[model samples]
Target: MSALDAATAFAEGLFEELRVNTTDAPGITRAAYGAGEEFAHARVRAAGRELDLDEATDAAGNLYLTLAGTTPQLPGWILGSHMDSVPHGGNYDGAAGVLAGLAVVHALRQEGRRPERNLTVMVIRAEESTWFPVSYLGSRAAFGGLPREALEARRADSGLTLREHMERLGLDPEAVARGKAFLDPARIHGFIEVHIEQGPVLERAGVPLGLVTGIAGSFRYRHGRCLGAYGHSGAVPRAYRQDAVLGFAHLVAALETSWDGLEREGLGATITFGEVATDPVQHAFSKVPGEVGFCLDVRSESEGVLERLHAELMAHADGIAQRRGVRFEFGARTGSTPAILDPALRGELAQAAGRAGLRAIEMPSGAGHDTATFAAQGVPASLIFVRNQHGSHNPLEAMRMEDFAAAVRLLLAFLAGRPA
Candidate 1:
């Protein structure tokens, strides 16, 4: 069978598998180490076996399927992406890359083509920030990026500690620390990930594919406090009240102002207050001390810029706390991961797209991804973005079938020495 024919068949099966395996709810609930994720892992292993690839699992729950090459001495090439999805995420985000990897393996097998280096496809878990406090859990573990105290941290929503949860999921937290899940630095020659654009840039520019220039790093901060008396709405005097809500509002405004300044400087910095909470109903007649907290997400393309912004935000947070008369505490949730892309690999991907007769554009990814983690590990990594509709993350999210086909074809051209 031709590579196109093989890819088509593989894609069809992959789409069906995703549709059938995922929940029917409006949003995806495949949280890290959840049952749905385990099912998906089983399916990936099955696909690998069908293609006569050897499958293995790491201590961090990352799955790897390897197809041996004719030159046994050569280091392997890796094609990877996470399989977990965000809540209410579309089918394409991480799923498309995984399916494309499967298709590549199948095409190579059909043609009896052995590469100079071994080829491995990886499906990493916990790319989404659902279960673990940090994102890219699997990739971080694979790269030995997890801190020693991280395993002891507890999820706020669930009483289970990180170690307890990992144990429940049949993973040894200590083993993971000992590099049991670590990748062989010398064995991986290059890495590639295919993902949906998750934004409208490519589609708006009328491009079928994007050669990702860099993946943005993220800096997350949680600021807020357990503050003074919430009193009766009507009875409390405006002068004598310690309002937690007012304090939170001040912090939020400061964050926005900081972001605005960064934007004016052309720093490409973004800040999002994703969560906020307060205790005790405002309507209650009794005076009760309430807690207020909010998350700040700052991202940028440069590490130095990110660090500078982080320091500025911290300073502003202190000022806000003092002015508001609230005892505020700031916690660093996740540190920055600077933008990194392999220049040579990016050029190769662009050349492949041109050979396949696909319109490709160079773009930067605003969101953090497993590709960033791999790049941090010194792997030559690149990303391919397929067109997405309106950059939506809802269940109704959709992508053009032809675009997916084009991406797969371009990938084939990159892998094999043939125009798609």
Candidate 2:
């Protein structure tokens, strides 16, 4: 097998290792900063050591494994993605990207061909907000952009603050609290992330890889609630009832209407309301529900679109509140800004793909990624999406080994300044 092929095989082995160890019945669970994440980190760290790479970590637990370049003084390149997975999520969502970085470096070693500039594989922490409700938790902390209050945010399952988790892992949460940045954007050459397309766009297009144009950003309300007055179901008349469920239904219908309008106007965004529930303790079949809780996720690539949606959200909520005699409260919102990727870097990768005879498509990513945090810091960044099946965030999510290999070869070609 070629060096790239061998490296690809090595990556497959690591994938199996991760799956076998982190299995949670229905799917894998690599909760942000949880045991599964810790296991994956340890596995990657061992791989770095085996490769004899220079290893370093930031105060917030972002791992960096470096293959030192010949010209050490030049600004270096970084290939990375988060290692955390959502609860009962597929194994490859985040792990594939990090492992791809390693495969590239391993290929370089096998061929004894190192780039002129340093290449670092970064394994980011806590990208899945299912654990802690914060966007780009690790990348933001690396750049000193994470809010100090985020440390106090509790993980959904563990019910422990992020600071406490860091403390348990022997990381310096106080340094992150003091806003110490490990990365200086101006000093880096570029950032590239090799991720599986979280959607089926590429699969539908019959392409192996995609050069991402931009990443969508979003505002999320994880603890949103609609409050109303409870009454006996039979006794509450339609006009006199203050039904929180009805108020929620109104908001959903109104936003969906606005969403349809945007689509007709050629605007792109997604509106999702999950975790909808009525308090089981206080709710009953024979009584009107006094309150309903939900999680709101709104995403868009355009800032204006996001602003417009936010305006529509408030307007609809106000109308619903007045009509249904209920109040809406969205507590402690968290979000990231949409990022337009560096086109020059993207063009380079396209050129590499062309010379390697690999078909690649240029597309926009609706899902958020760590690459956005790099782009937000003025660092030129590219997100390479490998084709996959069944989409992401589920056990059925799948990617062909050959497609992943195609992405690795493309990165290698980009580094070598020639076809792979």
Candidate 3:
């Protein structure tokens, strides 16, 4: 078998293993700094050892496996992505990127070929903000960019502070809080990530891969609430009752107008209320809902669009409060800035794809990725999206092994005979 074949098989086996071990019924769960994530890190680390790669880790538990270059002085490549997944999310979301990196390195080693510069496969931690409300938790921590207050952020399921979680895993949260950096942007040649497309664009385009141009930024309210006074559903008159659900519904409807306005202007933005519900303990079917809990996520590649949407949101909320006799409490805002990818590197990858007779499109990412973290740090970076089925972040998310093989081939072609 060829080197690529062996690596592909390795990835296939690992994927199944991950799915089996991390099974959470409907899908899989790899909570940030949690048990499933721990197992994944350990498994990948074992693979790194088998490959004889140089191993290292940071205060934030980001793992680095390096295939050392012949020339120690040249700037090297860092290929990485996070390992954690959203609750009941599919197996491929973040894991594909890491496995692609490994496949590239494993293929090179199989042929006993050494690159001009070092090649590192990084296993980033906690990129899924679904577990802890902070975005890019592990990547930002690698650059000492994580805010101190983020350490206090509680995990959504476990209700433990990030500090406590880190401590349980025998990792150093103090150094993380102190802003200790493990990666130097200047010394890196470039960063690249291979991930499954979270949307249907590539599958619809009849293509196997896409080279991302930019990644969207987001403003998220994870613990938003609508508060009102409870009343008897049958007895309370419509004029006097304060319905929290109606207030929440009005806000949802009002945001569509802003989205439509942006669409009319040829601007792109998305407004989502991912979670919405009234308190289970304090509510009944016959009672008027006194309160509603929700989480709002607004994203766009343009900062201007984000601001405009935010402004419109506040205005709508104000009007809704007065008319519905309810108040909105949007707890602690967390977000990330949009990233413009390195086009020069993208052009080079495009050239490689062209050379290999593979069809790859250039597109903008609506979803966020750890690659954005690298781009924000002034590192030259690119994101490659492999075609996927049924979208992402859910149980039915799917990617073809053949399509994955195409991505690994693209990376192999790009890395082959490249300059230092």
Candidate 4:
């Protein structure tokens, strides 16, 4: 069988094996630092063992399956992605890239083909920030970029700290707290991630794959709250009432208006108040709400645009608070700066894709990935996107096997042609 065929079969098999971890729906629930994630990692480890690749886990639980080259001392290449998924997310989101890496090496091994430089297939941990509210934990830790405070942050459900989770997994939390770099920056030639494009651009453009131009960065307020005086809903006059809900409503509207204007003016940006609600204990049908809690996420490919958006958001909040006589309390905000893909690697990928007779679209990624973390650490990084449908982060994500095969072919070509 061709390498593309083998990789496709390998990915399908792995997907079926891991799909049983779902709960509440037909999607995966392999949350980061959870049992499901552990199971998936075990499967990857087993696969690496079958290929006779040397395997190890880093201080933060990132798994590396290595195939040494003739000159192992030189900086090597890494092909990898995360293994964790969001709650009720699809099977292919993160797993596809990981399996693609393994399949490439497996195909090479079977064919007695060896690369000139060492190649490491990485299965990173906790790339999905849904559970911990911190993005790319595994990759960041590998690059010594994870903040110390993130180590002690508690998980939303299990209430266990990230450090606790690491200890349970037999990884040294102390090393992570010390901000250890498991993979030396100087010893890494490049990082490449194959991922499903979570947007409709590729599918709409009628292409099987795409080359990522850049990854958008984001600022998030995970636990923001607005406060105002509580008063009787019926008795309080609209002019006199300090309605917190109204204040929050106005804030959302203002931010959205600005977002709309910015987009119309050709600046690409997005804002979402993904979570918002009034306090159940303090809220009543007969009473005006005194508090509003929400989560805010703002993303952009341009740092300048993001800075302006942040300023406008704060200004709108201030105006809403003043006009409504409400107070705003924003929780700890975290963000990563925008990252541009390496142009040279991108050119290589495009050439490889062309040689393999696959048409590819070029676009920017709205969602963040582990590739961004590697780029932030000064590594030349690239991301290849396989066209997918139904918008990602849910069970309905539909990626065709044909597209998967096309991506595998491109990946194999790229790996085979890399400079020694």
Candidate 3 — what's its lDDT?
0.93
* Top-down TM-score ranking: 2, 3, 4, 1
Query: In candidate 1, which residue pairs get closer than 3 Å at backbone N, Cα or C atoms, i.e. clash?
Result: 27-88, 28-88
Across 325-402, the per-residue lDDT of candidate 2 in tens digits comes to: 999998977887999999999999999999888999999999999999999999999999999999999998899999
Expressed as tens digits, the lDDT of each residue in 251-325 for candidate 4 is 989998999889888999889899999998878889999999999999999999999999998999899888989
Task: Give candidate 3 regions above 4 Å deviation.
Answer: none
Off by over 4 Å in 1: 155-158, 226-228, 280-290, 390-393, 418-420
Q: How large is the C-alpha RMSD of every model relative to the true structure?
A: 2.8, 1.4, 1.2, 1.3
lDDT of 1: 0.76
Task: State how far residue 237 of model 3 sits from its true place (Å).
Answer: 2.4
- Cα lDDT, all candidates: 0.76, 0.94, 0.93, 0.88
Which lDDT value does model 2 have at 256?
99
**Would you list the clashing residue pairs of candidate 3?**
none
Better of 3 and 4 by TM-score: 3
Q: Which order, best to worst by lDDT?
A: 2, 3, 4, 1
